[model samples]
Target: MIKSQVGRRYSKAIFDIAEEKNQVKEIYEMLNSAMVLYRTDKEFKNFIRNPLIENEQKKAVLTEIFGKDSSENLNILLYILDKGRINCIKYIVAEYLKIYYRKNRILDVKATFTKELSEEQRTKLINKLSQKTGKEINLEVKVDKSILGGGIIKIGDKIIDGSIRRELDNWKKS
Candidate 1:
C-alpha cells in the first residue's frame, strides 16, 4: 500500500481511540506539537527517521518528552514506532487534523486579496463563508496585488475567483 494510505489508516485508528476517550482536541494538539518538533528539530527528526536506532530507544525518548502529558499520545507514538511507520508522522498528523476539523464543523479557507483587509471586512468574509458552508470558518488571509481588486477564496477543492484579473480575463475571452 501507499505511504499515505498507511498514514490514513493509522490516523483513523488513532482518531477513533481519541474520540472514544473524548480527547480529540488534546490528541490533535499533541500531534501538531510533535509535527512542529519533527519539522524544526534536525537532530530529533534524524533520530526518528534513523533505521539503525532501536525502537526501544526512540520510545524512551518520546516517553520522556510526551508521556507525562497523556498515555494516548505515548501509545500512538509507540504503536507507530513498533509498526515501523514512524516516518509517516507528518501524513498521520495532517490526516488526523482533517478528521478533527471535519468533526468540529470547521473549514480552513484561504483568501487572497489585493491588500490586507480591515477587521470588519475579515469578519464579514468569515461570516459569509460560515453561513454558506454551514461550518465555522478559519480564515487565512493573504495579500496578492496581482489580483488587482476584490479577492479569491479557496475552500478545499472549490475556488471562488472574484479578482479583477479574472474578470478581465473572462471579458477578453468573450
Candidate 2:
C-alpha cells in the first residue's frame, strides 16, 4: 500500500508535467512501452532492479535503450533510479495510464470468455459497455477456458459474471 502511494505520487508528478507540455499521450506510450519491457525482458528487468548497479550506470543504460525513441522527459527515469525507486516503475506507469484514460474519458474493460470473440462480437460489446458507462470503452479480450461458457466483464471495480460455470455453481448451492 505504501509503495503504491509512493508510485501514485511520482505518477502524478509525471502526469502533470506531461499535461503541461501537451505530451500526455506520448508520455503514456513511452511509459507503457517501458512497462512492457520491464515485464517481458528478464535481463533488462534484472539490470534495473539489481541493487549492485550504480545509478549512473542505470541512467546510462536507460539512455542507451530508450534514447532514440524517448524525449527529454525520459530524465524521469534517472530521477527514479537516483531515488532508488526504480522498482516502482511498473506501478507508476499503471497509475499514469489510469490518469490518462480518465482524462480522456475512456474506460478500459477486460472481458474473459471461453473462446476468442469475433470482430462483430467485440464491437457490440464495446458499444454496449460505452453506452452503459457513458465513457468510450477500450476492451481487452482474453480467453479463459475455466469460464466454461459465456463471458465475464470487468470495468474498474465492477464485475459482471455471466459464465455458465458460475450459474451452475449457484444452481448447485440452491
Candidate 3:
C-alpha cells in the first residue's frame, strides 16, 4: 500500500490510457499475470530487484520470462515501474486492478467462509448481493476455517459479518 507516489502516478497514467483505449480489463489481466509470474518465481523476482543487475539485464530477464506475450502497452507500463524502483509489481498490479474495477463498476467482494460453499449457494448469494449493491462483482473467495461457521462478505470497506464468532462474542457480552 506504501508504494512510491511516483509509481502511483505512472500507474495511474497508464491506467488512464488503457481505459481510453477500452482495454482496461485486458491491460489489468496482463499486468496481473506478469505480477503472478514474478511472484511465483524467486529467480525472476531477484533478477528484477537485484541492484547488481543493470537495466538491460533486468529487461532481458523480463523479456525471456514474459516473452512477447506481454502486451506492448503493458511493457511500457512495466518499464516505468522498473525505472521508478517500485519492485512491488504485485501491489502495482493489484492497485491498477482496483482502479479498473472501480472505473467499470465491477465491485470486488471477498467472501470468507468456515466451510466451502456449494456452487448453487455461491451463485444465489452473489446474485442477491449483486442485486442489492447494483454492481457486478469479481469475487475472491477464501476458506477461513477460524470463522467457526457462516461467513463474512466484504465489499469495498463494508463487511457483512454472519460468522458464528461474531455471534458468540455478542452473546458473551450480553
For each candidate, what TM-score against the reference?
0.91, 0.89, 0.82
lDDT agreement of model 3 with the native: 0.75
Per lDDT, the best of the predicted structures is 1
Q: Write the per-residue lDDT of candidate 1 for residues 39-71, one digit (tens) a residue.
A: 899999999889899888998998888876688
**How far does residue 62 in candidate 2 sit from its true spot (Å)?**
1.4
> What tens digits encode model 2's per-residue C-alpha lDDT throughout 1-174?
977997899999999998998888787777777778888999999998888888788888888877865556687767777888867888899898888888889999999999999999999999988898899999999999998999999988999999999999999999
lDDT of candidates 1 onward, in order:
0.88, 0.86, 0.75
- The residue ranges of model 2 lying beyond 4 angstroms of the native Cα positions read none
RMSD of each: 1.7, 1.9, 2.5
Task: Give the lDDT of residue 133 in candidate 3.
Answer: 83
C-alpha RMSD in Å of predicted model 1 compared with the true structure = 1.7
Residue-by-residue lDDT tens digits, candidate 3, 1-174: 466454466568778888787777677666677778777878777766778878877676656655755457647645755675446666667667667677778898999998778999888888998899888977888998888998999988999999999999999999
- Which residue segments of model 1 deviate by more than 4 Å? 172-174
Query: Could you tell me how far off, in angstroms, the CA of residue 171 lies in candidate 2 after the best superposition?
Result: 1.3
